[model samples]
Target: MTGRRVAALAAAFVSVAASAGLAIVAPAAAAPGCEVDYAVPSQWQNGFTAAVSVTNLGERVDGWRLTWTWPSGQQVTQAWNATVTSSGAEATASNAGYNAVIEPNAKVSFGFNGSWSGTNTAPRSFALNGVTCTGEPGPSPTTTTTTTTTTTTTGNPVPGDAMAQVEAMQPGWNLGNTLDSTGSDETSWSNPRVTEALLDNVKAQGFKSIRIPITWGQHQGSDHVIEAAYLNRVKEVVGWALADGFQVMINIHHDSWQWISAMPSNRTGVLTRYNAIWTQLATAFRDSPGRLVFESVNEPQFTGSSGDAQNAQLLHELNASFRDIVRRSGGNNASRLLVLPTLHTSSEQARLDELATSIRGFNDPNLVATFHYYGYWPFSVNVAGGTRYDATAQKDLTDSFDRVYNTFVARGVPVVLGEYGLLGFDRHTGTIEQGEKLKFFEHLGYYARTKKITTMLWDNGQHLGRTSFQWSDPELAAQIRSSWSTRSGTASTDQVFSARSGAVSAKTITLNTNGTTFSGLRQGTTELVRGSDYTVSGDQLTLTAPAMTRLSGSRAYGTNAVLTAHFSAGVPWRINLVTHDTPVLASATGTTSSFSIPTTFRGDLLATMEAKYADGSNAGPHNWTSFKEFDRAFAPNYTTGATTLTPEFFAEVNDNARVTLTFHYWSGATVTYHVTRSGSSVSGSP
Candidate 1:
């Protein structure tokens, strides 16, 4: 998927070359022998995703411009590649930015995804490389039309470059996940199965970004590690979204509290385990492209206020460690944009700075800070804001947005409004008064640009009542659609990217397996990319991609392995991988190698691996077994480490089909095995 693409809009230019005082005749057509073939999904033929493919019949083209007309009453709703234009019944095409040089025999394609209301016939007339298409003439060749009908669609995502486009192209939506499970649609993450329809609804309403807050309660019981099944479940959801062309964010959501709260005195041990978890997590997804992003941790909370700088210092301690974790992980994540949290995830409160400020100095070039807009937590809910004070009390709460965040704006720091909305659920609603909330949207957008910040809707897929301005609220949806749009024809450098981890430059990984050394580009957790630039290899993957204002990378699974990657920039870069599994063997950087199965590691276990940056502020334990649905042949990382059998932890195979097997490991320890049966348990192993 490279080379010239079609421009969304069409233009016409006639030349008049005359050395003498005489008008010179111009060619009737700009493109001479171009041809086009178009086919879109039945659901797309009319809506936003109008499929248009162009071919070169005569010369190869460096770029292309595709323009056509749908019958009399049809037109393009939105366009990309080239600008689109429409007249009464005619359509035309022209160059976009630079000239579309058509070689003697090559062609290219370009198009945009848009939504439409009523069904419209596909345009039959088209132009390519430098010629007209074979289809019957559609409308006149001059006047073009535009559609008013609205259709919502997800961006198309491919491995390499498409992910960046997806993030930039995606509309905003709220992350349904949080640290502590709220347990219901009103507060916490909804189950994935139940959330599918909600996602489709999101796309229908035209949203592109979704932040999935995850809690790594994987190993809640032991080894101070995360679990595999939990990570597997998260991966399942991420895969679905990426396959749907989505820009997703998977961060250490609730575990921030779990890791930070009820602190233990063994700080060094905590740091060691914490660092280990990140190392393992980073290695697992070493092959992921760029469609995915890694949000280091959710809001870093503190019980104390300005008086307790010590607690703040505790938060700051993670700054250097977190950076080392990411830079060492290798691949695009090296320089990928990593998101950090502030004191309590508050722009105003966090404004005091601590880890929020230190994170700014990471070796990685693409890093951003994250904050939430709870504004007046309990007050907004009406429960805390207090029942009186009329207008004055509300103003007190409102000043934070304008007064507090303004500080960060002054510092030129990039931030994302992680959580913010008028919570009018079964609980309360007072973040804003009335229509005034809409102003929040507009102001936020304008302010972000001025402040150079990014904002995400607290959430948009919640089942909270639609009557109020919530996830399901139609009014809220309308506000987002109206206020946030890239219709101005001008583009911004800051894009909501799917890849937020980092980048790699001439990356090479040396593996030590059976005393054999292997080297190549290290794979990154990034979920999207431009296919022409990178590829995956062996269990340890490597890649190098361009780092621009708009492209970044992140991890899919929470913790995996460590990688040593060299980039054109940054010295002694360090990344993090967090996992419960023990690394048996790997490279010096810890990116590639094998893991020694724990004596307790056994069963038809499912393992999920994820990567995180070393900013190691918040992380959790993870087991290397849980992801079962993935076809292992295609993606081996999903395979479980090992399985064991223990009476208390084992399951039955069947009643009559009992089979027995003996323990063969060198040592005797409790083994947890996976068993599926319709009836009874077998006396021994299957």
Candidate 2:
């Protein structure tokens, strides 16, 4: 995802030596005839994305090469959809794998991201297959043939449950490189102009959502007021997408100048600008249907000399401010679904905690959590087809989703997958090929459907053609559509229970799930009554005294207990716990732990630790002990002698489950040193 700019030709002169009075030239026969559409779709001041399409009007060709020269010394830095080579001002592009063949009257295209100084212009002449094209070159074409058939918006009822709505929003597409371009014009980034026909094409292909990442900072004035013209343009594009029956998401994107991490020196101004931007957007879209969503920020994070604690505190405050501003903006804005991004939109466990903690206690049920997934970065982003699309890659994808589900979805919160995609690197062809792209899409689609997470694919004028109004790879497009329909049964409801004091006592309990009737819920074989038993509201189902008494046998599960397992001597073969029967929670491998059990499984659990060696012999699950029996300690700084660091070392062995150690020293005059632990050695910082 780079920026784009419109391509302009640098004027050049074609000359010949004046040897003879008159130079006689014979008219050529039916040589190769072609037309070229060279465009720079996105650009920054120094870089741009260049896209070219060549149509063969003459005989068929199995392979083709295009050669052009840059007068402004623009260098091709990276390319996709073709193999490109540059030497000085001249550049040549060869056909990649799937696009090698060009039938009569058919077209082939490729693109590249390039850097420039002075001026950026398209080559004056393009020689396709060594025969110069006949089409005149200036700016690229502005329109595509629209389909006669159009589908109107259904104005579907907005589901009260955010997660349910997210599930309904299946496969999605991004209008990337166009609006999100760092350059001036929307088309500066090499993508063709956005048209009604394009929106129609996307909806016709079964995409349920359109994510428009727009950079608004560049269009604002010194007073921070967005330009009227720019707002109108955004409205026009948004209207097109919504008219074509697509859910649309718009956000403030790529504003690096104003985006700073949690630092007191810069935070106040950042929040002010954020409020200004969202207030305008919210007011404008207030009358639009509920399908229109406002994302607070693309990826919010701190920059320069900021610690994790400070950034975390700032992110929390920023998210709360975003929520308050939109709500106060009035109109439909009060109830409009808002998306809050985690730290850097990351899916890491600790980052998830940071996001959840920051936004906790908000009463707005319409708010949906969001994060970008580029799990196993190398495998998912800018990757070769060969390295990805394997079993390992599949595991990485699933594991990432599982973490998201456990972190947010398992609770009452809903999550939107704002961004996820394969970088589409085809090695042999130097263009996007089928196999890996299809597999990645399938995994994305299947995960979205099963996990009930909304997904949007990132496109940068490659996989799908913005000009042709057709998929560059038809099979890949079909795979995405097919995977969208591949889903399992309805997701199971996660219950929130309550505990009472006495046997057969009466107390109300709430079920934290999207609505179902009182009779719909049962404890073992007993059916509960409506008003006499429980009441329902959104995802909360509250049970009455009689119903609670009847359901007394069920333990109310709340409060998540964390399991911290530390390996010092050697890693275990496997970690196990027995309640109903022995179940292996995780297989140990590394020097640390990556396993956690739900807090609901809190009472009377037994840990059966086991280890296996390289020789294939297994150790015993010999340690059978109560989790509660483990010692929990707390101590303040105490000095034993003069001029010694206080509380030098502390260690705790929780049965055979985990071991934790810490060292502390007094900040002031008190100094002491000591170590507590036996039969095991340890080393590390305080």
Number of the top-ranking candidate, with lDDT as the measure: 2
Give RMSD (Å) of candidate 2 vs. truth.
30.3
Q: Of the candidates shown, which would achieve the greatest TM-score relative to the real structure?
A: 2
User: Where is model 1 more than 4 Å wrong at Cα?
Assistant: 1-171, 177-197, 218-221, 264-266, 302-307, 349-352, 376-379, 383-412, 423-446, 460-471, 486-686
lDDT of 1 by residue, 87-106 (tens): 43544343332234555445
**Model 2 Cα lDDT, one tens digit per residue, 1-686:** 33110000000000001110111011112216789899988999898998888887776654466778888998777776665756668776765434656887888888888889988877898777556787633221223112111100111112366766666566778898888777787888877778988888888778898999998878889888999998999999999988888878898877733454434577778778877888888788888988888887777656673444566677677778878888988887888888888766766444565565554446567878888764443343322112335666777678667657655676556788887765424221222223344556656777766776888877777767776878876756765676666521111112222333334333332331112122243433354455776665643455465655444444443222111111121111111111121111211221111112111122222111112222323211111211111101211111211111112112223222223211111111111112222234322211
TM-score against native, each model: 0.41, 0.47
C-alpha lDDT of residue 29 in model 2 = 20
Q: What is each predicted model's overall lDDT from 0 to 1?
A: 0.40, 0.55
Q: Per-prediction RMSD in angstroms?
A: 28.3, 30.3
